[model samples]
Target: MKKTRFHNKYKLIILGVIILLTGCFGLIYFFYRQSPARGEESGDMVAGVSAGALSNTSFIKTYHLRDTTHGYGLFPTKDGGYLVTGDTIAGGGMAAPYPYIVKTDAKGGKVWSRDFSSQSGALGYLSNRHLGRLAVETSDGSFVTASDVIDFVDENLKEIYGDVLLTKLNKNGAQLWSLMLGDHNIDRPRQIWALPNGEVMLLARFLKTGYSSEITDGIPEYSVFIKIDKNGKVQFSKKMEWNATGAERLVDGGFIVLANIAVILPKPAENIVGPEVVPHPLPTMIKLDSDLNIVWAKSMEMIPTEMNSPTSYAGGVMTVGKTIIREAGGDFRVIQAAPDGGFVAFGYDNLILTQGMSSGGAINISDKDVSLRPLVAVKVGANGNYQWAKKLTVNLVSGGSANDFHVVRTADGNFVIMKDVAHDALGVLAAASAVNIGLIKTDADLNPLWVKQYSVERSVEGYGLWPTVDKGVVVAGSMQTTKMHYVMGTSEPYTEAALIKVDVNGDVGGCAAVTTHTGATLEDQSSYLVMQDMKVMGSENLTLKINKKVKEKVNNAKSAARDICKYKKSNVTPIYSLLTSSDGSSPTASGQTVVPSTAKTWAVINYENAKEVAVVGEKNQVIHAELLPILNQVYNSQVKMKDSMASMWLAYVFPRPVTRADVEVIQKNLEGLGYKITGSEGGDLWVSKIGLTLHLEFAIQNSMMGKLEVRF
Candidate 1:
């Protein structure tokens, strides 16, 4: 019996071993078969080629075209597809780019694609091209496209300038008629408005060098209007003394032109340039007759709010500067005729110029301030007088300069604006601009209802937007990607054409788009937590009065408050949330719990955090003498010094360790602040005997400030 039991046990062991080996082999085969499928799935999602139903994911649909393709404009077709226009750089970045257009179905499927390179030139022979701001679908279902032949000179070859290039294409993407309209001088159309009567009006600007005295001399830009019939033949042309930026036809058979006229300030008494007084650019509105005769021109005053004026510098960040006054003007970028017959002009305003170091190692102060470009709106009556103008005070995600590129009047009578923004509001990114695109919806009076921002890793520029047939919005822009090649020690930037369609409610398909609005939590509503009333404990934290709803939610909440605190100057971070009951009951300190970030209602932010190490003046310079005037003059810029402080920090952040070149600017500025360098180490330095030490350290390839201890 024992021998039989041992034999059975041995058979059982052998059977288990066989099953384990078979299972292992099966698992390996399964994973091997699925590898390719997983890789392809990731490629489809990033390539934006999935036939994901438009009705399914409505939040946002991103499309990535071929290498070095840019999308400049988008227009929705009657069949629920979209028509996009942009330039394509084939061959490589060094090759000339050609205008490319695509027609995509509602589901973002490519219906057809056409590249104008073939018509411009043969292969290997590159041809440079520029698409007009947009291509519109004409009343006859065809497309009307315009471009500026750039860098082209006249027969005499005096100067290179852009000439108007127009092309009409049929439904099948075949060119029907191509024409070049301009004199021997520069002529370019900035915008085009398609009329209901099958006619198109071109809002063009021309060089003033060859025109009459009225159109030339003091005026550098002349507003040129050309009306063309369906045959693309000019019916009439008119010119006037206006720096036309944008325009729209009125319902009364007339036109309202949005322009930026130079406000010529009288020459300062110190310098007598009587007739050559420089003009400051300001937003102006001009009403023209059907014959294109200027009836009345109205230039608006600065924003009435105290913060909008320079005198309010001590009160708010919206104020530019007390002494850095430039022209309080903005160029009308986008204009739309309101439903009530009035016209709305949207642009940047309250500009101030500052003096700074130029690349040529020379100090050049700009004629206009580079720090502030508050987007403003001016409402003009039917008769061309200003009704009301106000700043669109919607808090931006990244504080920076923003310009509106497109505006459309929604079916609900509100206005939608598409703008491009950069991250550095302080002009610290050198000359490179553009980071993201923002969409703002405002009422008829220009009050912001809500704002939405869309961004990728790199810069995204919003160029054009149109109302879709489904009452949604179709946006056209460009998305860029970068790749670094270590072998070549170089970086290559590749741009792709991007298109996004949002439903009528500002929702992307079925996904609700994230917006820069106060998401009031249930606790906030029950307790009436007004953000403005939040007590500021210091620069980093704030105290909020917790009600019953907040108390109960805090005990069960996951993490602390993580939403943004929207302020007038900028939207800022809210680092932590410390909750306390109204009855003075404090919750037990426990482990940090994960909380829903979206449910956060409180935000704490500080706007005046200095980017540079603010230097201080000597005791004698502060006690009996004022330092602001001295610092302001020595800095030769907009520097506001208090009674005790004599310095402003530089904008560059210390990365890794500070280098000698980096510390040189700081040392020079400190010397300007009356600080004498008393000691120095490899990369560390000390000034005077005031106990100020700047310790520095170095890594493999970079340096950073190790410690900055200041005792004053």
Candidate 2:
């Protein structure tokens, strides 16, 4: 007796037929396609263990993300977070500069990272700046770093070009100030430090006039240490004829200076003997008084041995040394410098150069810049006597590829270092044989108090350092599931984000590292190492389900073409109404039934129906939804029974849990041509209405729109 909308638009019998078909399709789909989609991600683990390395040097935990940026100018913060500066891979000019900064929690997990130089490549804008050394903390709790800018312009702002870009960031990663260093290629900063008198000093290299062209410095390079007030006013500045690599403020408020001298050996002497002539690294050191006057200067002797690049700083000197590194098993020197001059001190073992076939230049000499070398830490006593010496190996040597550490003395009078390790190698190799960082805490005596190592899953090495904090050691990494079962194949390789927390004991622990955004389709290799977290942002099951439905739709058409092809006039187009997994676990679900939205599909045999194309297609979809309750036999469910497609439509719905057994059965059933099945519900299946001239699918989402189309 109820006057339905279909009643007003069609004859009573046809309207009844429409409602009945809708009910039948709905029932058919309910029992077939439709299952919940959800699961957890796993990790791959290798053999081995070392409790207190740097990071996961331990073999237990396998956590790590593949797409995180390696932190440059790494520093740990007070609140247990890290503040790093680097450029996004997308904007990075390879060796060129494109400035950006990232802030991560104490655990090396990113809170957020932003690129200030996204426009570095826009129009005429060709370059930006990369961060150098970090200076002292400001009165307001923020800190500053020195760097150089190039062809930079801030729209609506006045300044541009090679200015010294001084930036101050808060504990929460907010930018508070940006001070430019130069107007053009004339000036640039090499190092920076904080003064107790509310002033900041920068140690930088400057070029005389006319050096602005791509590569020429008229009067060679002079190093300048500049002092500026909190307001950016230049209070005093000094220039050293030679180039300085860095500058730092000593504990006593004085400054430490790092300089570089090109040790030219007059290659002609070497060329006399062979085709190749080897070059070497020189030693450079300078001591500047408060007024930026050069108090003392010195140069290190040519080590004549392997010299690794290890950066060092003290009251009036900055040093860099080398050690046995990477695959190159050779002892390197420990170079140092001070106010009076430089010391080409020797450390590590010693390099042994075996005679090789004659090749000239670049080959014989061992130096810092060319190899993966050992890292050295140096501290000079007030009286100039060396106070202490230390060298880290094992995890520090080969592991340097993955785990780098930051050494700092904590307020508690204890010293702690942070490192990273790769833990998942599937026993193919020992975790230690790969990469891992370790945090070794020692007493003021430098005696090992406790050691904790953290390891991650991926990265032949492991997750790069995030940041370090107080309390325990904070770190972050990522992980993923290995290959799918033996033969079923894999839909995708998924990954998740993780943050690791360690107690003083270095026991297995946890923290907050939400892995909400983690998947990305690899469309372009150029964009492989993305700076942002991965782009996988949807349900994993949804992907397979949509694909499954499409396959089902395809399966049905092929079957119809084959089944009735003998009928000659029988159209071979497939019709889709229900969904089923080829493996049968059609109605996939855990708790709530996660299923695809309901809809219908059909092919137009004639274009006339094409005008009604949109409408005609929708009717079948509604019928499919309507029949869900009926074919599944839910009487109380809202559905009108219709035998309209009874002639060609055969309904099948998965009622219970659609398991592996079900998948096998369904694959066999749909083996012939023209059989289309959809698991509207994960793990569930539903057959399509018969005789569709075109193949299509039913897709529904957050909105109320339903149409015959491919499942996305």
Candidate 3:
């Protein structure tokens, strides 16, 4: 009996020892799951994370015709297509210069093309230069274009005079009617606007008398604003003293005109043979009512001028400088309606020419003596009051001109300026003579966010720019190419219409490297200008035909210079896989605890923690079971996981707020374990490998919770 009691005591001792060890392990797991494991190495836990492939729809396309073709205007249609207008030589010859219009689908595939050569033949001209520079789609689903048609030709088929032509076309590329406006001289339409009431407004430059009657030397050009009905009848014709460079219709049935007025500066007394007056072009803004009545006129003040020669003159006034015959030349090329019912004008300024006379009474001036300034953007309020002006500093070539600058306001209240610049200007290493199209993105206040240059082997001249629905931009222009020309005896470079589409980041697919530039801005100044109104007559209806034609598509991707000009890849972060049951069973299997049916797996990563936690699925359970022990060992803390029927989602609560560094540590650990970082934005990161995707959402505020979602 004593021996049996001793054995029971030994059994009790052994039971006490087993209980103590069980309590120790439970305590270890409890502390491991409770402690935050941020910044701890994830080791092999993320090795199997993976994602699916991604796709994009960016492209670079060039349209080829029989002869030379130029792209002048590009507009997005309501059907997600594009309309391009310019001049093209027909029948592979220069004798058939016609105003050309081509429509393309969203992917830059040519849908249809039309030329005005057949219609212009009604004017009894077989060989004339017709240029369709601008076109806009009306609310009635029709299209209208403003062009310049050579009216008179010499014996050698040379253009003698030009007339403004307005042609309206149906949606199917059929011409409805045409109108011609001219004064038996040079009349070129600069801009056109479609009215809400089925009417159209046109701004044209008319060659007229000189600005000054006393010193009548050079023929001065004036701007004419004409409103015409849908039936090709003129409604109102109002003429202005200045030449309109840009114009747009306002929302309140008003109009804003950006023009340049030639301020005549008196010639110095020392010059007896030269002209009596020097014409200096100044940028002016004019506001007019719907009836074409001028409301207010403001001009950019003459920038401070430094005399390079002996004489300097500006704003018709001579400064403390010698006969440096200073001639300021610049004009605002484009304007757009602002968000606040205002207007923004963009142009280049400070183009000065200084002329000095030698002791032998000979003029000494060359093109090299010209001084060019950076591009400028000016903003004005609805009341015609000057708000702000900014100078866009760019590295411009010494003798090169940047007259073909275009600007378009984005949907986000920002502005984008497209201009031609040397490759070096954009920090691109290329030939000294290489030129590229530069795009500058600016904020609402004209502060440049970034600058990018697009180029090929030859030069690129961008003429049209339009913002895309994806907050990107579509640029249409001409690119030069060297081809064999039998008539030229040697291979010569010709231009073809080119279209390039890029995303907001200015990144092109297949081209990993992009040259970026840091653009600077400066405060600018402006003043006011005097305005005068005049009257003009209407035009006669003309017969014109828009003949359907076909244009060849040059595969930019197969071109030899394809490596130089790249297209955009995918701009969106792709989601890899969807949730599914690993055992191929129904998601609503009996006895399975499933998440709420209305729960969204991919929710926006806000600061607030998820209201309902997610449960782990069968596939995630395996990974969860393997990951917890590994994480527990690495972090010296216990890791816990939730289970569900739909998918696997693990929420890790940190004792302190999550930090960028902590997130970086976790990302690095996953990358080291063979997981690829597919994308990262803000505080969220996506990691994938094989068939698994791990979306790590780190909330840096509030509870500072980090949620890791596993999907297969």
Candidate 4:
């Protein structure tokens, strides 16, 4: 509290992390060496989660507040319902309740909400509170970009220059037109692309001054790309001295410059500093435009200062385990910029300070600040021009820490990555950094056929992705630790905010049996766990309990959950069942099918997974048989899952013989429940009994890696 670093929550860390990942999540992952099958966290909040490819099901969107602002925005509202924006700082800095925005209706209530002119506090005016990074809906329904920072004395606090400011609501919040964009510097506003022809694209960043004659390029670095139309009018403004963390909007019209392009270089002649630091070549990009006039631009040069520059851009899994920073790690090799601009990146080569050993014994590498690891995704080919080049080799390996992952593109098209992973947990048990949300499924020559892993505890830099209209993958970030419960609190270490839901071949989390993108509503809260995925949704898993042994298991199930179970708030109920097999292709998010009869037994219970007395649900819901055996460890992944249910395994129940009376009835019921066996030999016995056809043969053998064969 006396330090001044990344702040907290935006407001809190992932105390168990959000019910999980308050930010960019993928809580539905699978690896299967063994050990997993835990569910049960019923705080309620589900209306219709289960969509696309075959997992068809929808309807979910109920939680209204608690702390939100990762730059929220999600279109479709001439008025029918839904516009949501973020930043509501609670009772803190800036002014009083700003960045808000609202407009709900498919069912979040509030058909009107606003803040911008400058209230600062609740969610506006910026400075601590939140919200800034573009938000749009304009074309008349009014809703422009750049908010937060409603107060400041001198240099104006620079909120992307605090105010390209524009507000013009109608569905109810009312305001018709309020402008203020560009007076001197700070035009921050990031990402807000929408040009089916209406043209709006604006991925801005301009703090301008110089670059550092000491503290001047205005002190923000550089990154700009504007093109207005919905009434603000800017037309063009393409700049890039090297400093843009993100920029999307390219279904094709143009605009995709995930930034960093400032390679000043030329500092060190000698002066190595203390704890090992050698970096200063930050310039990673993927530019392409037409209006601002940059037909193409692709930079990514390294080997230069201040310890690795291509900073910021992390995906879910909650990172910060400290790889030495430089954006944890990098293996980015995204190509497609060849018209004479030339681009062929195959990057990989970043360690930035290694040296390990922890668990109290000391000597933990110290930390040069930004952390490090990157460089593993190499394989380039470009022709737009040339400049962002790389090629290096030299590593002896002392504690490992390299593969800095996050290069998504999955749900069938191929390419899915998100790893803040750390392997080698074998010996006296030391090297730990377990936050891996990898669902790799490459093809089109991108190689890698199947690689799935999901073990998040904390340390995922920051992200909140969303691209599921019907392909799969609806990630949101924020975590410090989580088992996904909407009112179960704990990670008070950083604060709290986590939200997860992964399904679209990413392999199970919530909503995905094939409807593509329907019903994605996570909404948990104590500190926070929000999700609204209503691009086309439904399913009411909308909890409100505040945790107390889950209101003593809902005052023992029913009886109106102990009269609305108190704890500031409580009221949850929304459960569905669907599973497909026998040729329905591969549907699960509740398609609920069976009837082939070999005994045709299919069950499913939801608990958000992990190892909570209720890890993976519905095999016999006496609340899932009061689950617990380390939550039925199969293949043993310790934990991580959002709501589990699977089916089929009868290869004759599996090789059989673990005999010796199945290790004497699990060593006399885990020594009459004291549980600490260590191993009296004999294994294979994880039967919490999952179904929906073993969750569709574990999502079609994790979407094809095993070749796809699920027939119970």
Candidate 5:
């Protein structure tokens, strides 16, 4: 009987080995078929259509782990599998969310899922009450996780901030031990890097308990480096003054830290106004030795000679414009260590004001819209000197925020960037424009090759991206499921952890992770104007007529332009005590504070239209002053006509699809406004206003912008 049992065990062992070998071979063959040949040019897309890059790549499979699971980190294991760690909010009699770990096969099928929520029996001691921020596989096949847990009350009866917890688990997902490292305040890790020497390094922020002292009044946070051994034992902790946002390991065993510094500049003395304060933002780069000691630091400066080059060191500071550079926003958020020992970083550049507008010397005029901010890429040399920069312009209707948070490099020396974007073109309001994942494939030189987007019915934000051995990509993020309807009682939260796997060409194999269609359609541009047209029109023209006595002071009508424009030219006389707006708001105060009357040589025109008034001061103030009122009348007349006509056109064309009922309403409104309903074509309605033929293409989608065209 003993010999028979032993023989059966041997047969089972041999059968298991055969099954493993066959699975490995299948994976190898599958990957071989998916990958492109070496030296092949990457696929390109023109006008929202891909050439061949995505044609072959299709979604093979997708795995939804749980109801509420956030996958933050993914790693390929040695056995053609993957390990992912995040947090899960489970449903039970007493529900408590905790960090979770999952193992999957090469085909994205779940092998095992583990929730590390076990706690100690001691009172007030909470275990596994944290979310895993990062994880990596160790040499011995075990995993090390860096998670953060918040403690509302400590053992000492004081409020303790969140602490970083390090846990070690075996290959089967069983916990070996856990170590929590934090005291007095918050110690949050921004990034974790597994060193080649079997050690882990964490770039963290150490927020001190109290505010800054008198000497360092402006600095409040500290950037820190915490190193630990494989056994979860602390090696050393080093800290610096600046607060770091992103970091990466360098080829020379050093590290590069990216941060922004605020430099306070002295106000100009000649203006003789109150003590003005100017804050200049300096995108700074700091190099640190392997031991966590600062090696050298470089900051942006405005040296007058080199400001011409946008990528030059001096170009970092805009010295010629306004006293403060608040309108345009830029921040370096993530950095990637280049193969050539250099570094590439991505962020955004927001231009708030147009060029011709005056912004300095007390009167600030800026555009309120910030949706035009473009994604920016900055490249630096090995020594941290600025080399070059590129701006990725997004011309979406009513622009939205597009930011690249993570990046990965391909085997062909190209790069794949991952971003989460929200824009007006995607939806109507901010709530409807829940962020979507955006991907951009670029060449080795950082030039964009193709762009793609992914989203579901709700918002999805991708936080981590990894390149697989098969040349495919894996992305992990959080997804929210919004409630379509609400009731008087019951609570429903809409947050889920999501993972998406795309082929080497970025196609989701027929899954719900739909490709985002962007770029504005014509209909999106015209909806709101039509709605306004349906409302009652109140004809009110409040114009400011300059006194006849002031016009007599000007030498000629042409000189009046100088008074409205060249207020500082010294030859123009000051004009004050003009009629303010009906609500008593000063016409000169266009969102900016009034320039002190003590600077009497400068006079502001109280006209309704700034664009129509040609500002001319000492050189031609006399003529400008005369033209200001006449130009205001002409501007007022045009605006009033457009407002009245907008309603008539909208009443005829809206609730569109050019239905028979809508056409009757439109024709009646047009006739009331003294316009002729000329013709129709394939359900499109056409009207004649004055000498212009207006074509109202109907069947408009409500969530889009308004659109209108003139038929020549």
Candidate 6:
């Protein structure tokens, strides 16, 4: 009887212990659901966390000033700010798009916003699209934008006619002048360059005759180059044969234009049915003299038709004396001036296929189901001779392909390419199609250094990229969000302008691991193409009209467009697992390295290889207390620290180039905080308080770049 009683007591004790353990796990899971860890889902952590906060310079933000907004171009200003050009549409049925521009400070804070359609009387019409693809800052600190505005619309809300519009604004966002050029046809601006003589050069695609849809044999297009003065006067206008896509100003005051020409292939590629010959579009580069005369022209060759792998040709064999035909469409999209006085062009190659005659003498073309496409990069010398070509093949796991791409050379002599990859719901098992931005950094030889993919939103398209002084990059684009349309009584996708600033490692606070791509294969195909001379037409001056301007009230509220639009910060950080060497081997170490506590310390450690010194007393706490107030006043600036065995000093880096006006403002702000200027020297000022001393120094790197450094 006593043994039975003891057994019952032990069973009760075990039951109580199990219940306690179960309750503890339940509470732990409940708290985890409330506040999950970073990089668990979207890889986003809330800002301002003291434990693992991001650097003050890194940010990912979306701005919605209207119902729908799209960012097309981004340019850095001399004042360390940025200018964004895009279009915005109202929240109504069949609303027309208006050219929009926004200027922001270095920290991505909006300074001023303008909608040209609301200001100009010429733009007060319902149209289909108004696309502003390029903007640049002039030597005088003014801004200029080139846009294609469809001003005429039919009764069915269809676009009828389009014109090229050039608008200039002062540094304060005030309109200086506006001009429109058209010939009663579609005239789209392709590129604009600011000259050193306060003049601007514009390249446009002009439809000379015939409707774009009705042209079947050849595209009835002409390349128009116009030189305009600062006062909005057209100095000269030159016309060329084909449609121009890109242009770059040579160092010797000349220019190089990238255009497309029709080329007819030889022999068995001809159609067997008719006497008509299909002309394939080929990219050609034309160099122009300062007087608008053609110097030389070079056409890029097609990718070779032969492949080492048998499956690439779909098991078909080439007949004797028969050659494979090049694809019908291929064009270079971007042309950038290289450091070696030459130019680098980037584009995609056409798909491969072979044409032959069947047993019945009919045309038979065998094509393979290619899931990958090669992105081509070509380099040419200053004399317009081909230097080298590299091909990159990207395997899209989302079953999509690359869309738009931009390439820029970094300060470190590397090239960074930003490309958009489209993702379909059928392949990704999502609700809709989306686009993710991909960044690939390559060495001087076009070998891949690293590749990363960033999904900022469900659908995002990057159109502009600029490298920063800190070796990082900023990407500006448009992201889509779902919004309820009151009139349509349904939800529709809305667009907002997105700007992302990442560190040198392409990190945005938190990142997750993803699949990596091998290095891009490089092949030397420089001997395939030859340069020839092309014809250049005469130059003429065209008339320009000034449009009326009306100032609109700037809205600064973040929730102003809440009802009609949505803004989203990026939740996912890009992965950098694809870092590789020139020999296509993975690196043993990860691409990321732990940076020092401050920027000055990091620079010292990297450049000087200095050892770290620990703080002796409560000096760090005292320094933080004294510096927090000053930092709060100049919250937009970046702060770095210099630590030594004796003392620690804080350095404040101004966001904009330092001017007398900026210095005076800082002095006033500091004086309000109990600091007084004690002495002054050439481009240097000293301020002091009861126990603190501050030094302000203005240094100029070049005629165009300057910086302000503050030490205390």
Which segments of model 4 are wrong by more than 4 Å?
1-102, 106-163, 168-171, 183-186, 190-204, 207-277, 281-712
* TM-scores for candidates 1 onward, in order: 0.53, 0.40, 0.56, 0.22, 0.55, 0.59
Give the per-residue lDDT of model 2 (tens digit) for 79-109: 6555554322322212333344455543344
lDDT tens string, model 3, 1-712? 6544543443454334334333332333232222111111111111121334334445676766646676667888888778877666544434455566777777777777776642225221222122237788876788887777665322222245556667777888777876766554456777777887678877777665312234322437777777777777777676666667778787778877777666554554431212222234556777777667778776654222212121323444332321111122234678887767778788764322111111111233222212213566677677766655545454333111345677887755667888766544332234224456777776555645566677654667677888887666788777775543543464556667777776654545545334555323333333211112212222222222111121211111111122234444474532211122222222222122212112111111121222343545577666566455544544345233322344646654322344566567667777877889997765687888898887776654322123333444
Each prediction's Cα lDDT score? Answer: 0.45, 0.34, 0.53, 0.32, 0.45, 0.53
Decide which is better by TM-score, 1 or 4: 1
Kindly indicate the candidate among 1 and 4 with the higher lDDT: 1
Candidate 5 residues 624-675, lDDT tens each? 2332343234333221101112212321111112244444554565566666
- lDDT per residue for candidate 4 within 1-712, as digits (tens), equals 3212232321133222222221111111111111122111111122333332354212223222333222244443444344545443332222254444555553234455454433332124433222253455655455554553432222334343343454544445555444444324434465565554344665545455422233333225455555555544555555555554554444456544444343333342221112222233333545455443345454332211111111222332222221121221233433322222222233333222121111111222212111222223322233233222211211111121322223445444444444333222322122233233334433322333333344334332223334343344433333333323232353232212222334444444332221111111111010110111111111112111110110000001000000011111112221222222112232222112211111100111011111232233234243223222423432132222323333321111111112344345534654454434333432322222333221112221111011111122
Candidate achieving the largest TM-score: 6
How far residue 327's Cα lies from its native spot in candidate 2, in Å, is: 22
lDDT of 5 at 523: 11
Better of 4 and 6 by TM-score: 6
Least well predicted 10-residue stretch by lDDT in candidate 6:
37-46
Better of 1 and 2 by TM-score: 1
Residues 1-712 of candidate 6 have per-residue lDDT tens digits of 5544543443343334333333332333232222111111111111211122223245666667667787777887777668777776676434666666788877667787777642223342322232246688886778888777654322222256666777788888787877766554566776788876567888877676523343323458777788878877787776666677777777777887777766543442211211222234557777778877778777765322211111111224322221222222233677777766677777664322111111111222111112233456677677876666655554432222233567777755567877765342324233124666667776555655565667654667778888876556778887775544454676676678877776555655453222334434443333333233434333444332223222322223231222111222333322233323323443323222212121122112121222233434465456455554655455353433324223444333333334565556667776877888897655677889887786767542211112344555
Clashes of each: 21, 116, 19, 166, 39, 0
Model 1 accuracy (lDDT, Cα):
0.45
Residue 226 deviation, candidate 3, in Å? 2.0
Q: How many clashing pairs does model 2 include?
A: 116
